[model samples]
Target: MPTGLRASDAPTLQRLCGSDQRLFLRIGQLLQAKLAFTEPALGEIVGNEALKKLALDKRMREVDATSFATLLAEHGGDGDLVLVDGEGEAGWRVIAVVDELGNPLLAPAPAEVGGAAILATLSPALRAPVEGLLHAGGDEQRAAALEQLRYAAPPLSVVSELMPMLLADGAELVRERAINLLVAAGAQIAVIDLVRALQRGDLAQLGRIADAVSNLA
Candidate 1:
């Protein structure tokens, strides 16, 4: 029960919190304005009893608890709830749980890690989504994606898949992180590619990539 939210607001909040993307955007904007001021508002949205119950209900359908737990842990902490709809003859559907403030409770880690692991397992079909998260906006999301990449052990044939991103435009921290992971994973060809990029001055990345390469030799 966040301050300023009346009992009358509950129903509307519940509906919006269910799966409303626009409401989420609005909440994101508000939170960006000031998290301290918005905490109560966020608490109200994330703490909704109905939403929690729905998430629990959705969790019951998962066949794998480890997968479910990972997903829940990733997205749940962010205040986003994931709902899997469809049962019996219907197919399962994913619904993002948004708090009243519109922040998704689900963290991006599980998806990133799971997706990367799937890729490492050579399931080409799962690569795109996992790679997509590598470019996700938040530092935490990018970090999670990079951590997954670190663990992927992708072969040289697939090293190209991640090369572009490691050199793409992003925060210095992200680029540095990517470089470190690639190096540690013994992505030799990828490192060579990065070295080429650095030599051509094609990548305006942080000084760390160059430093990393220097140490590698």
Candidate 2:
């Protein structure tokens, strides 16, 4: 016997679901079951008509408070509700609102793994939450991440920082992928340094540099 959702809980749940589709499917399943059984507590939290209206109103407004308020009077607030000007507001809009924080949040995407404490340090973890993606996953995901790296205009110093991981990767495929990414990213100086490291008896670091130089020839 399943329960139904209450009036208050629906809006928040709906908002969360709408924000992320995959999450929505998971929560939607639970909500559906609760709705079927008339679950009092679940219903109370998930079925709020007022909240639902607010969520809908928020959506209709989109991310622009002024335009949103003009169309709908429910979301009128004069404070910092509207993000305008400056780096903080811009960061919030890009990271929190659009979820595209990789560039704006982190100076260089890979440096995000071991850089400062802000969003950059959290970028790698955020992008690849699963251990499989971060640690020793298959070629597919690593290749994908490497491809993304090619498009990023990170500093050469950052590329130098990441060279060791690429050079020491256990998988040949990962090494190859890293070489391709570095080359695509125009890290010629870093490539030369990696080649020099290989010449200095760093056998462990030869794989990626070797592959990259071979491609150059």
Candidate 3:
């Protein structure tokens, strides 16, 4: 999504830091503390404080070809707290708040999210196009839509409509996509449903086989 980090941006960023290692390290430490685990595998890392902190520093510094400032802009993001998706080739492999761009004007008052707040964050709008294809499109289109949903990382609730594809007569790829997304989201469903789907699928295959046999006869 983001282009290359400009070479000139480095000196500008360094000048802004003013060579204060203590302050810089402190900012880094704060970022380590604020890392949130939206992903499951990354969630496991977040559980370990010392391990996660170690990974956090490396992730922030892992610009590779890109500058740290650029990675910060691309993944660290544009907010008071720059949120970084750590699950790339390098870093802690978790989502982190790499740095705070500026202090908030108002006093810090964190509040619990309500139902509407939760819905807004999930962003139902992202699923609209995919849902359209899932409802009426062919297997290939359905599979592609599922891939899009997977990448988009919609909320667990978004998976409900897609889950039925697992038991659908065709579109094996769509079923795989739906299951993978559900597993990644960590939304548990009944094993019985999956078992039944497999059984039903097998039965359908058997029926087709029986029809072919009858034709041969």
TM-score of predicted structure 3: 0.30
lDDT top scorer: 1
Clashes of each: 9, 22, 1
Residue 6 of model 2, lDDT score: 20
lDDT of 1 at 113: 42
| Candidate 2 local lDDT, 59-178, one digit each (tens) | 432334345334334543222122221243121111012122223542444444532323344346333322233454666776666656655544445554565445444455666666
What are the RMSDs of all candidates, in order?
18.8, 21.0, 20.8
Predictions in order: lDDT: 0.41, 0.37, 0.38
Task: Report the number of backbone clashes for model 3.
Answer: 1
lDDT of 1 by residue, 170-213 (tens): 45566666665556556654355444444234434313343443
The lDDT of model 1 is 0.41
TM-score of each: 0.30, 0.29, 0.30
State how far residue 57 of model 1 sits from its true place (Å). Answer: 64
